[model samples]
Target: MTSAPALEQPVSTAESAEPELPTPVVAPESLSVKFNDVGRAFGGRTVLRNVTMTVNPGEVVAILGASGCGKSTLLRAVGGLDVGFTGELLIGDRAVSRYDERTAVGFQEPRLLPWRSIRRNIELGLPRDLEKSAGKARVDELLDLVGLSDRAHLRPREISGGMAQRASLARALARQPGVLLLDEPFGALDALTRLKMQDLLMDVHASTGTTVLLVTHDVNEAMQLADRILLLGCPDSDPAEGATVKSLVTVPGTRPRNRASQDLARLGSQLYAGLGVDSH
Candidate 1:
C-alpha cells in the first residue's frame, strides 16, 4: 500500500475571505457535467438548492448523504431522467437534457431480462448501429472484464446476487460511455461480496478511465471508491430549495488502494466528520 499525501493545511479565515477558488487539476475543457447553482423542487418540496460542481473526465465522484438529502435526485438530474429541476447540466458541452449517447445509468437492481442471458444483457447496452457480430464480440469482452465470462450463458435468476450485479456492471460498461451513473450499484450484496465488487469496479475504472458518479448512503463505500466525495445536505420539501454541498473531501491515497491502509481510514474520518457522523 502506498502512503497518502500530507494532510491538507487548514485555511485561515483571512485566506478564505479572498474567495475565487483554484481550478480543479483535471478540468474538463467544456465541462463534462456542470451544475450551475442548480435548484430542484417537486410540487411543494425542495430537494436541492444552490448546488454547484463540475465533474471532469476520468474521475469517480461519490455523493453521500442521509436518506432525504437528494443524492438520488442529483444522480437523476445528471442521468437525464428529471427535467423539472432549475439548473444547467452539460455532458461534454451538450446539456444533459439533450439526448447524448455518451452516458448510461446503472441501478441497484440488475434489472436484466430473465429471457436474456448475461451476454445478451450486455449486448443490449451497445449502440444499435454496431454490427451484430461486433456487438456480440464486445459483449463477450465486457463479460470477461467483469469476471462473468463463465456465467455468460446464465440467466439473471440463475446466478448468485454478486454475479448478477457483476453482469449489470458489464451492461453499463458495454456502451463504452464516457460517463457512467450508478445508484447504489452494490447496496444489496453481502459484505464480502460488496468489497469484492468495489475492487472489481476500481479495476474497470482503471482500465476504461470512465467518468463515474455514484450515489450511496454508505460513508465507507464512498470513501473507498471516490476520488472525491460530496455530501448533499438535508433537503426541504421542494426539490431545489435548501439542499447544498456540505463538504467536499479529496482522497489522497495512492492508486490500487489497500483497503486496510491508515490513509483510507484518515480519509474516511474526514468524510464522516463532514457528514456529522461519529467515526468509531
Candidate 2:
C-alpha cells in the first residue's frame, strides 16, 4: 500500500489571524435500510439465516465476521445483487427486488476501465436521463470531492492503487446515492492504505451524510468506520449452517474519533472475543 499523504492543513498568513474555512456541504437526506429475517442458500446449503436488522438514515453500519460468515451476502442482499435470498430486504420504503438508483455499490476491487480516463469512468455512474452538461458538472464535482481533480485526465493504470480506489469511491458517489453499499472496499489495500481510506471515507460521509453499509472481516476497520457493528456468525462450527447476527455493538463517541482511545481498545477486545478469537 502506498503511504497516504498527510491531509492538507490551511496555511495562515501573518496579516490574517485565521484561515478561511470552506463552507460545509450538507448531504441530502439518506434512506433507511431494513432486513426482515433474511436468508440465503445454495445447493441446499445455507449461508445466511434469520438475519434481521435496521440501518437508520444517514447511519454508517458495518457487517463483520469471520470468513464465510455471510457478511458479504447480507450486503449483496441490500444492493439487490443476491436475489436468491429469502425474506424481505427493504431500502427505504421499497423492496430490494430490482436495481434502484437510490443505491450504489463499491466492490473490493476498484473495477475501473483501463481504456477510459478517470473522469469518464466516474461519469458512468450518473443517471442516463441527466443532461450532458449536467452530467459533466456532476462528474467534475465528484472528481474534486474525491481529491482527484488533478488526475482527472489520467487513466486507471496511471494511478496508484489507493488513488484508484478513491476514484472508485467517487464513481459510487457520482450518482449521489442515498445508500452506499461497500463490500470490503479497503480489504485489498495494505494496512497503511486501509487506514487512509477509512479516514477518507469518514470525511466523505460527514460531507455527504450518505447512508453506508460496509461489509468487512477486519474488526479494527469496522470499529473505526461504523456507528454500529453487526457481528454475524453461525451457531455451529460447520460451514453448512447458515450465519446470523451474533451481536450488535455500538461504538461510542462522535465522528473524527480516536482509534487508539482506551474505550475503543476495550471495545475491540470484546469484539475479538465475540468472534471467538483469543483477545490476549
Candidate 3:
C-alpha cells in the first residue's frame, strides 16, 4: 500500500517514470438501451411503472427524481441487477437477462476488494473466457483510461477516495460494456472531487463512446452531464401508480458544456420545479 497521487494531477505517458507500454488493443463502442412499460414493486407497493424510453447509442442519459421515487430501481432493471419487474428491458435489441453481459455498473461506492492489487481488481471485470492476452490488454487500457496506470500495484486502502473511485470506474469499463450504468458515481466525493470525477466521466465517454445511464439526485449534476435529463415522479393526480417519466429535457449545449451558461440555469430551474423544489 502506498499514497496516491493527487486526483487533479494529469498523468501522461510522456512524463511517466516507467518505460512506455504498447497501447491497449481494446476498442471502445456502445449500444442502444430501451425500457418498454417497465414496472417494479416490493412488499405490495409499486415504486416504478410505465418507464418507457430509448437511449440512443453513445448518449448520456441522466435519471433525476426525489428520493425513493425509483430512479435507481429503473437503472438496476436495465443492468439486470434487479429483474423482478414487469415489461421488458432491451440492451442493443436483446431483452435483458440475469447478469447481462451487455451492460456493466459503477456503483456509488468503489466496492474494491481490499486484498487485491488495483490491477487484479480490474482484471476481475474481464470476460471469463476472453483470451489471456486480450484480457491483459483490456485491463491495461482501463487502468490508463481512469488515470490509475501508475498506481496499478497498490491495494485499495492505499489510495485517495477519488483514486479508488477511478479504479472502480476502470473495472466497470473493463467489461467493454455497450451500456454503462452509473448510480450516483460521484455522490460520495467532496465538491471539488465530485467536479473532477464529472470531468473524468466526460472524457471517458468521449474516448469510449459507451451509452451511459446515470442516476443522481443532484439537479446541477444532471444538467452538466446528461445529453437529456429524464425526470421521474408519480403523477400528482395518480400517486397510486408509482413513479414514471415526468419529463424528458434535451440539454441545450455540447459535451464539456458551459457550466456557467444561463441556458443551463434555466433548464436546472425547470428540473428543480419538477422535483418540487424551489429554485430560489
TM-score of each: 0.83, 0.89, 0.89
Winner by lDDT: 3
At residue 248, candidate 1 shows an lDDT of 76
RMSD of each: 11.6, 7.8, 8.4
Q: State residue 31's C-alpha deviation in candidate 3, in Å.
A: 1.2
lDDT of 1: 0.78
C-alpha RMSD (angstroms) for model 1: 11.6
Candidate 3 residue-wise lDDT at 182: 96
Residue 224 in candidate 2, Cα distance off native in Å: 1.2
TM-score head-to-head 1 vs 3, winner = 3
lDDT of 2 at 169: 93
Give the winner by lDDT: 1 or 3.
3
